[model samples]
Target: MSSLTVLVIDDEPNLVRSIQFSLNDQNIGLHAAYSGNEGIKTFTTLAPDVVLLDLGLPDQSGLDVLAQLKALSPDTPVIMISAHGDTRTAVKAVKEGALDYITKPFDIDELELLIKRCGEQQRLSKELRFLRSKQIHTQRIIGNSHNIQQLREMIEQIGNSAAKTILISGQSGTGKALIARSLHDIRFNDAPFIEINCAALPEQLIEAELFGAERGAYTGSVQKRDGLISLADNGTLFLDEIGEMPLAIQAKLLTFLENRVYRSIGGGKERKANVVVIAATNKDLKEAVDAGAFRADLYYRLNVVPISAPALSDRTSDIALLVNFFSEQFAKQEGCKPPIWSDDVISQLKTYPWPGNIRELKNLVERITILYPGQTAMPKHLPNEYKQNPASSRTEDSNYSSVVENKERELILSALSQCGGRKGLAAEQLGISRHALKRRIQRLHIDL
Candidate 1:
């Protein structure tokens, strides 16, 4: 990765040069300006990843500079540097939007760690903001089937009410998360909608990531930080795949849901958040609870307003609507004109039982857009799986090899199709070597 561009604004040349040398050796880019006016001017041009502003400057006070820089780019992370290490100064700087306060005699290693942590946090926050804005501006539930209608109605009612917890359950790729986002949108304000995948992180990290951790709370936790729940105060926190959460974390989450109060991993004053937590999963919680994989009490608490997402096969009538919508969407995304779908193609799609549901359909359309943008989508343009008799795609057969081979073939074909017939790119996308991809292609008798 490229180094972080850090702007250092201080009148003291010795400290500025020392930091520049120290960070440069660590592959962190640094820029310096001695006066406040010069610092602000340089900042406008550099737009660095982080700013280190000294409390005392030659031309103006650092507080005035901090205010201007914030007004210019409010999301930029700024750390206040001062000789006075008083708690009052630290609190005032933080209250005025500085990320942290560092005394003049700060350790270089400590500063580096702080810079990395704060920089990474702001980057993640900015990315989430971009994605949320894009979603808010362009995407929504597209189908109008009875199932989708009921979902919209549920979202409307939930949005209008004061429901704090919602449980969305459905098969994989059936847009359970989308439904969560829908619920968020209905009651949308300036509050954030934070999402964390329970299965994505290790058990040890999930608690800290959720409720937060103090300095020295865990290995590598160099600085105190706010968790997703805290960041999402007065907003929404979408817990994706909550069924996969660790048993211990599940217990803690249940407690928080019960009373809105939680303690950090290292233990501090009890904190409270007023965010709506929407948990979604593809698993049957009742079965999980019965099997002892999920807590019964937690399951009951989450299932208060249970919503079941409909599979694509259950709403065959909406196939065409979804396909066309996905086509136009991927087209605009890939910067190509939308492909035209024939009536016969639509009929064939409606016949298939989409095990992966809406997600599979969406991925296929995106592949088509990349492969044959602006062209009419004909039956021949369909993947081999789509061309097969929909009845044969059923999983009722006990032949394990046949099912695995079919799925493998579809996966390879989709990768190749998405990469425009480039073996290297396809292999990369499949997380396999080019040689491996060749062997599979030959073994599977893939014509491509």
Candidate 2:
């Protein structure tokens, strides 16, 4: 592979020379520009993979230059350099689209790591853009509920740092992948998101899949291919269902996590992998560790920062929003009018134990939209399991009984009013016959 190029922008000639020399010693090509204007011109001409931008320039501010460069090439990653007291300025640069910011007189090692991360992020962003363009509909994390609000706050804090390892734990369908993707999009949208389901992979081939095989590492290895870890170098490798990773492989993973290095299967050379690993699992890894099924050391290595995806039950308030979101999404894909859901439908959705979480709810919405046309989703529109199980109707507040009764009464009134007070017509509109409507009305002792 060719050596990566880094462009350094600073008014101080001494700082520029030092950065250039240090980077060159590492065999990375370095270019320098003395002012923001020159830096933008050089950046445009050289198209360096990463830019170390000094926030203060003689002619123009670094933030202005960053804004211009971003406009020119949105995918390019910029790292702002600031003086000791200019931390606020550096932060403003980040908000203006810089990849990250570093303090003036930054450690050589830290600058190198930042440059490397920028390159990785750039590569990943290209891949994600491609994936997004191909996808039919992408689900976004949307909510102002306390749970969602807290998660967003944490994600913002995490994204501001260069932390590499993150563990996202939650029950199945609780949107672990969504959170992982959010993190990737926030910091490393410039890199390819390589996702692998550990639970789905065969244990025998898992190692080779992760670390790459050397054209004959084992049976069926016809070509030398880069492993996910290698492919995600400077990018994110999202390991879903990571708890299912075999114990033997966990040891190898730990080695890579510890040293940021790995040897390909059947290869003699040990290569450094600068990938950011984000592992997610539905199972309780602590319990697994206690049972001797999971390695505690590996768990700790991956859990540098732990994030929990809130379950559906934990954030029921978001269900109505989610349902509307998914309903419109499916409707657009299917080329139909977006379906609406009555409050009763939403109420039932909020009450059901979403064992499958957001994913399950999304699937249900899709199924309902596809199967029922020109109709709002109601209790009858739900699947048999949700409909038949009255136990699913329990809400946190038992006063929900009044809510259900109100819904029932509203439906009856709407049916009668829509049918112009004709019992037979109202019953038919309500999807029941006149006899059933009469019985329900009598049982509830409704005036109308």
Candidate 3:
């Protein structure tokens, strides 16, 4: 382990010397400051793991220094040392955010133990933060196509904004939930991220699950329950498959969305929670609204910041990247080497229309990694659906062809506009060679 840094802010030379001598064998990097201002400056520059601050300073009050230190870095542990360490002063120090208060002539051994404890705590806190960051990065949406890039930019915009209601619309398995989680993780990683699937729950119990239930509200309600909304207070609440939410519950949810307040079942008092609601759905909410299956008002409210996650077929250029990423992830999990994709396998993958989208691609990669570790993945290893109808995979669906063509045309035109109508520059912007860009423009019948 690396050495822990401890900053000591005190005007007493003898006491500073004593601390240095006693902790010399503890393998700690000790830094001393004679005044509060100097201590703040040293703390800012060094960013030490722990601070030993004296209550009596030559320049300023220790309480003021303590507050300033916390304002700079709230997580760094601060211990107060003073000669006049009465109960009242200790209480005051702690109330101002001191981790612990020590009196003068304190036992050297006890002080060393306290420093070690603080060092361990700081290490654990840093580890937890690192793990959280890794988790966020692992769960991020992976793609490089124009549609995917636009989706990512929208996510960042909405994540940084104060928009409380966001709706993610996409086909099944296109990673709607993943986008929702990305938005939450970016801004509210330290807060709760509660997800509830409306399609998974029965209509009769969804209201209770979302808004909680009071004691004796129903046959099974023996005690008061905190629902997902209440649990997600000051955090994010992701409602997946929101189109499956019943109409009655839709009204209640709309009310909550309008005014961050709701009441439990069989309870009279109203409760409020500050939650950001991110809803995802595979079904066409507008069609459902027209059919009277969903409320128009609720749909409008949830669609405050709508984001569309592109299907796998719409972003064929990203298939190889996804394949490699999933292969490595599964290989690490299974304790095996990742499989290499041959040219034939890559070509075959890009041609197939992934109806199951990214979920299907991930599953296929995991299966290949587990069955043929350290081997080259080829077309023969792919499923029969991919091999038998490789050429006709996309042609079979007329609606899909039209959608893909429109998206392709739009992407090409946007690239051309961005590059000032220069074919070579547009090709580079779109991650393709000039010849390929010319072929696409000709095929799409795009005007210059």
lDDT of each: 0.80, 0.79, 0.82
Residue 337 lDDT in candidate 3: 49
- lDDT of candidate 3 at residue 412, scale 0 to 100: 79
Model 2 stretches astray by more than 4 angstroms? 1-139, 392-448
Compared with the true structure, what per-residue lDDT tens digits does model 1 show for residues 350-383? 8887898999898788767655554557889876
Which should have the higher TM-score, number 2 or number 3?
3
Rank the candidate models, highest TM-score first. Answer: 1, 3, 2
User: Model 3 over residues 1-448: C-alpha lDDT tens digits?
Assistant: 4799999999998999999999998889899999999999999999999999988898998889999999999878888997863656765676556767778889999898778766755665564444345545323566557987788778888888999999999999999888888898778759999999999999879999999999999998999998999999999999999999999999999999999999989989999999999999999999999999999999999998999989899999878767877876786665444666765787788878888899988977976775455455778876565765665543444364465568678877988888889998776555445776787689778877
TM per candidate? 0.58, 0.57, 0.58
Runs with alpha carbons beyond 4 Å of true place in candidate 1? 1-139, 391-448
- lDDT, candidate 2, equals 0.79
Question: lDDT by residue for model 2 over 1-448, one digit each (tens)?
Answer: 2467888889999998888877876767999999988888898899988888898899988888999999988868788899999997886676566767889778999888667755754554454444345422222675547998788778778866799899999999888888888888778647888999999989878898899989877988999978999888888899999999999999999999998899889999999988888999999999999999999999889888999999889999877667766765775565443444656777777767888889988977876665442254668867555664647543344453465567678888887888889998775555444665787688668996
